[model samples]
Target: MNVLIVHAHHEPRSFNAAMKSLAADLLRGQGHEVVVSDLYAQGFNPVATANDFATRADAEYLVYALEQRHSHGQGTLAADIQVELDRIKWADLIIFNFPIYWFGMPAIMKGWIDRVFVSGYCYGGKRIYDRGGLKGKKAMLCISLGGQRHMFGPGAVHGELATLLQPIQRGMLAYVGLEVLPPFVAYHVPYISEAERRDYLEQYRQHLLGLHQLPALEFPSLDDFDDALRPRNAL
Candidate 1:
C-alpha cells in the first residue's frame, strides 16, 4: 500500500519523532511505499492567506474556501499546497503523527488540513462524510499525550479519548470520506521509561502492519440523514 505520514513535531529526538521514524522504516521493510512530510523541519507555513493564490478569485474580500476552490480549479494553487495535494492524491493511507497540544492537533498540522483539504479537492457540496471526494482512502492519527490514560477516560479530567478526537476523526477525516481507523495513542510518553517508549514503538509497528485488517470507526452515513441533514427518524 502507498502510505503518507504527515509528521508534526519540532524536536527530532522526541517520542513523536521516534514513532514516525519507526513507522517509515517498518512500513518500507514490509514493501509498502512510504512518504514522510516533516512539517517543522520543512518550515511549513501554517497560516493561510491571500498569499496562497497567485491569481485572486475575489480581490475585494478574502474568502478562504472560495479562493481555494477557484485556485484549485484554475490550477493556480500555491506550489506548496499543490505538492501536498499531489501526495494526498497518491496515497492509499495517510497517517497524522503528532503530539496532542491543548487537546487538539498542533497548529501546523491543522493548517496543513486547512490549506490542502480545500473545497474543490477534498470536499464540497453534497460530497461530505461517507460520500466525500476522498472516499476509499484511509486515515489514522498516531498521537502522543502527556496525560495518563486514566485521565482521558470517562468521568476523568479529559473525558473520553474518542470524544476528544471526534472533531478530527469524524468532522475532518470522515467528512473527507477517509475510512477512519482507531488512533494509536501513546499516553504519558514523557513520564514513561525508555523500555515503555520502545514498547509503544513496537505497538505502533504492529498497528501499521495490520492496517488492512483494522476496522474503521463507526460514523453516520449520508443515508442516515434527511434532506435537512437531520437524522431521518427525527422527522
Candidate 2:
C-alpha cells in the first residue's frame, strides 16, 4: 500500500515530527511506499490563491468561504498536482500526523486539505455514504498533545479527544466518502519522561506497521439521539 504522511509541525525535534518519522519508517519496513509531506520544509503555498482555479484568476476561494473541493486539473498543480492526487489514488490509506494548535489543525495541513482534496476528487456531496469520490480510500490521524489524558475526558480540562476530532472523523473524511479510523493519539507528550517517550515511540512504530490491519470505520449519522428528530428549518 502506498501511504501519504502529511506533517505540519515546524521543529524537526518536535514529538510530532518524530512520530511522523516513526510512522514512515514502520510503513516502509512493511514494504509500503511512503511519502512524507513536511509542509514547513517544503514551503508549500498554503493560501488558496486565485491561480489555483482554472476559471478564476483574481479571486480567492476562501474569501467567499468556499468549502467545496476545488479541482487542480488545470492550474499550478495541474498535472504535477495530479501526481499527488495519483499518489492518493494509488494508496490504500492516507495518514495525517500533526500537533493540534488552538483546538485545530495547523494552517499548512488545513491548506493542503483545501488544495489537494478537489472537486471530482474527494467528494461531491451527492450520495450520503460511501458513494462519492475517494470511496475505497482510508484515512486516520496521529496526534500528540501536551495535556494529560484525564484532562480530555468528560468534566475535565481538555474535554474529549473524540469530541474534538468528531468533525474530521465524521464530517471531513467520512463526508468525503473515505473510511475513517479511530486515531492513535499520544497525550502528555510535553511532560512525559524520556523513557516513557521512547516506549511510546516503540509503541507508535508497532501501530504504523499494523495500521492497515485495523478495522474499517463505520459511518455515523446526523440522526443523533441527543438532538431532536424533527428536521430543522435552517440548513
Candidate 3:
C-alpha cells in the first residue's frame, strides 16, 4: 500500500518527529511505499488567503472554499497546495502525525487540510460522508499529548479523548469520506521517560503493522440520512 504520513512537528528531535521517522522506516521495511510530508521542514504556509489561487472565480470578493473549487477546476491552485493534493490522491492511507495543541492539531496541519482538501473534489453537495471523493481511502491520527491518559476520561479532569477529537475524526475526516481508523495516542509525552518513549514507539510500530485488523470508528452514513440530511428515523 502507498502510505502518506503528514508530519507536523517543528522540532526534528521531538517525539512526534521520532514517531514519524519510525513509521516511514517501518512501513518501508514492510515493502510498502511511504511518503512523508514534513510540513515545517518544507516551510508550508499555514495561512489561507486569496493568494492560494492563481486565477479567481470572483476577483472582487474572497470566498475561500469557492476559490478552492474554481482554482482546482482551472488547475491554478498554488504550487504547495497542489503538491499536497497530489500526495493525498496517490495514497491508500494517510497518517497525520503531530503533537496535539490546545486539544487540537497544530495550525499548520489544519491549514494543510484547509487548503489541500478542496471543495468539489474532496466533498461538495451530496458528495460527503460515505460518498465523499476520498471514499476508498483510509486515514488515522497519530498524536502526542502532554496530558496524562487518566486525566481524559469520564468524571476525570478532562472529558473523553474521543469526544475531544470529534471535530477531527468525525467532522473533517469522516465528512470527507475517508475511513476513519482509531487514533494512536502517545499520552503524557513530555513527562515520560526515555524508556517509556521507546515503548510508545514500539506500540506505534505494532499499530502500523496491525492497521488492517483494527475496526474503523463508527460514523453516520449518507444512507442513514434523508435528502435534507436529517436522520431517516427523524423524518
Candidate 4:
C-alpha cells in the first residue's frame, strides 16, 4: 500500500515525532511505499490567499473556493499546493501525525487541508460525504494529548473525544470521502513513562501492520439522506 504521513510538530524530539518516525520505518519494512510531509520542517504556508493561483479567475474578487476550482481545472495551482495534492492522489492511506492543540489540529495541518482539499478536486456540489472526491482512500489521525483519558468523556471536563474531533474526522476527512479510521491517541504523553511511550510505539506499529483490516468509523451514507440532506426517516 502507498502511505503518506503528514507530520505536524515543531520539535523533532517530541513524542509525536517518534510516532511519525516509527510509522515510516514500520510501513517501509512491510514493503509499503511511504512518504512523509514534515509540515513545520518544510515551512508549509498555512495561510490561504490569492497568491495560491498563478492566474486569477476574477481579478476583482478573491473567492478562494472559486479560484481553487478554476486554477485546478486549468492546471495552474500553486507549486506547494500541487505537491501536496499529488501526494494525496498517490497514496492509498494517509496518516496525520500531530499533537492535539486546544482540542483541534495544529494550524499548519489545518492549513494544509484548507489548501489541498480544494473545490472541484477534493469536494464540491453533491460530491461530499460518501460520494466525496477521496471516497476510496483511508485516513487516520495519530495524535498525542496532554490530558488524561478520563478527562475527555461524558460529564468530564472535555466532553467527548468523538465530539471534539468531529470537525476533522467528519467535516474534513469524511467530507472529502476518505474512510475515517479510529484515531490512535496517546493520552497524557508528557506525564507518561518512557516504557509507556515505547509501548505506545509498539501498539502503533501493530495498528499500521493491520491497517488493511482495521474497521472504519461508521458514517451516514448519501442514501440515508433525503433531497434536502435530512435523514430520510426524519423527512
Candidate 5:
C-alpha cells in the first residue's frame, strides 16, 4: 500500500511532527511505499484563490472521480497545485497528521485542501457520499491534542473526540470519496508519561501497517449524535 502522510505541524520537536515521523517509519518498515508531505517544510499555501481553475463556468459542482479527471477533464491544473494532485494520485492510503488548533486544522492544512482538492481533484458529478475522485482509497487521521481528554468528555468542556472530528471525517475525507476510518488521536500530551507515550506511538505504527491487508474503515453507524457531531462542526 502506498501511504501518504501529510504533516501540518511546524515544529520538528513538537508531538505532531514526532507522530508523523513515527507513522512514516512504521509504514515503511512494513514494506509499504510511504510518501510524507510535510506541509510546513514545503511551505504550502493553505488558502484557496479564484485563479486555481482554468474554467469559471457555472454549470454545476462537478464531482471528481479521479485525481486527473475533475471539472476540467485533463486540460491543465495549476503547476503548484498539481504537485499535491500527483501525490494523491500515487497513494492508496493517506494519513492526515496535525494538531488541534482552536478545535480545527492549521490554516495551511486547510489551505492545502482548498487548493489541491480542486473541482476535479475531489468533487465529482454525484452528491456527497456518492462515487467521487477518491473512490478506491482510504484515509486516517493522526492528531494530537494539547488539552486533557476530560475536556472532550461527557461532563467536560470540549465533548467527545469522535464529535470533534466530524468535519475532517465526513466533510473532507468522505466527501472526497475516501473511506472515513476511525482516527488515531493522542490527547493530553502534557500529562502522559514517557512509557505511555512510547506505547501509543508503537500502537500507532502497528495500526498503519495493518492497513495493507485490512479494508478501508467504514465509520461505524451510530444513533443520535449532537449538532457538534455533524459534518460541519467536527474539528
Candidate 6:
C-alpha cells in the first residue's frame, strides 16, 4: 500500500519525531511505497491566505472554499499546497503523526489541513461523509500527550479521548470520505522512561503491521440520511 506520513513536530529529537521515523522505516521495510512530509523540517507554511491562489476567482472579495474550488479547477493552487495535495492523492493510507496541544492538534497541523484539503477536491456540497472526495483512502492518528491514560475516559478529568478527537476523526477525515482508523496514542511521553518509550514504538510497530486487519471507526453513512441530510429514521 502507498502510505503518506504527515509529521508535525518541531523537534527532531522529540518522541513524535521518533514515531514518524519509525513508521517511515518500518513501512518501507515491508515493501510499501512510503512518503514522509516532515512539515517543520520543510518549513511548511501552514497559514491560509489569498496568496494560495495564483489567480483570483473574485478580485474584490475572498471566499476561501470557493476560491479553492476555482484555483484547483484552473490549476493555480500554490506550489506548496499542490505538493501536499499530490501526496494525498497518491496515498492509500495517511498517518498524521503529531503531539497533542490543548486537547487538539498543533496549529501548524491544523493549518496544514486548512490549506491542503481543498474544497472542490476534498469535499463540496453533497459529496461528504461516505460520499466525500477521499472515500477509499484511510487515515489514522499517531498522537502523543503529556497526560496519563488515567486522566481520560468516562468521568476522568479530560473526558473521553474519542470525544476529544471527534472533530478530526469525524468532522475532518470522515467529512472528506477517508476511512478513519482508531488512533494510537502515547500517554505521558515527556515523563515516560526510555524503556516505556521503546515499548510505545514496539507497540506502534505491531499496530502498523496489523493495519490490514484494523477496523475503521464507526461513522454515519450518507445512505442513512435523507435528501436534506437529516436522519432517515428521525421522528
lDDT of each: 0.92, 0.72, 0.94, 0.94, 0.73, 0.95
Tens-digit per-residue lDDT, 39-152, candidate 4: 999999999999999988998999999999999999999999999999999999999999999889899999999999989999988899999999899999999999999999
Residues 126-174, model 2: lDDT tens digits = 5434664777788899988778789887888878877888767776778
Winning model by lDDT:
6
Cα lDDT of model 3 by residue, 48-67, tens digit: 99999999999999999999
Q: What's the count of clashing pairs in each model shown?
A: 0, 0, 0, 0, 12, 0
lDDT score, candidate 1, position 206: 83
User: Ranking under lDDT, best-scoring first?
Assistant: 6, 3, 4, 1, 5, 2
**Alpha carbon deviation, residue 105, candidate 2 (Å):** 0.6
The collision pairs in model 4 are: none
Q: Using Cα atoms with residue i matched to residue i, what is each candidate's TM-score against the true structure? A: 0.97, 0.82, 0.98, 0.97, 0.79, 0.98
Better of 1 and 5 by TM-score: 1
Q: If ranked by TM-score, best first, what sequence of candidates would result?
A: 6, 3, 1, 4, 2, 5
Q: How far is candidate 5 from the true structure (C-alpha RMSD, Å)?
A: 6.3
Candidate 5 segments whose C-alpha is farther than 4 A from its true place? 53-74, 190-193, 212-235
lDDT of 1 by residue, 1-235 (tens): 8999999999999999999989899889989999999999989998999999988889999999999999999999999999999999999999999999988999999999989998987998878999998999999999999999899888999899999999999999999999999899999998999999989988988887787789999998999987778888774
TM-score-better candidate, 1 vs 3: 3
lDDT of 4 at 201: 89
Per-residue error (Å), model 3, residue 172: 0.9
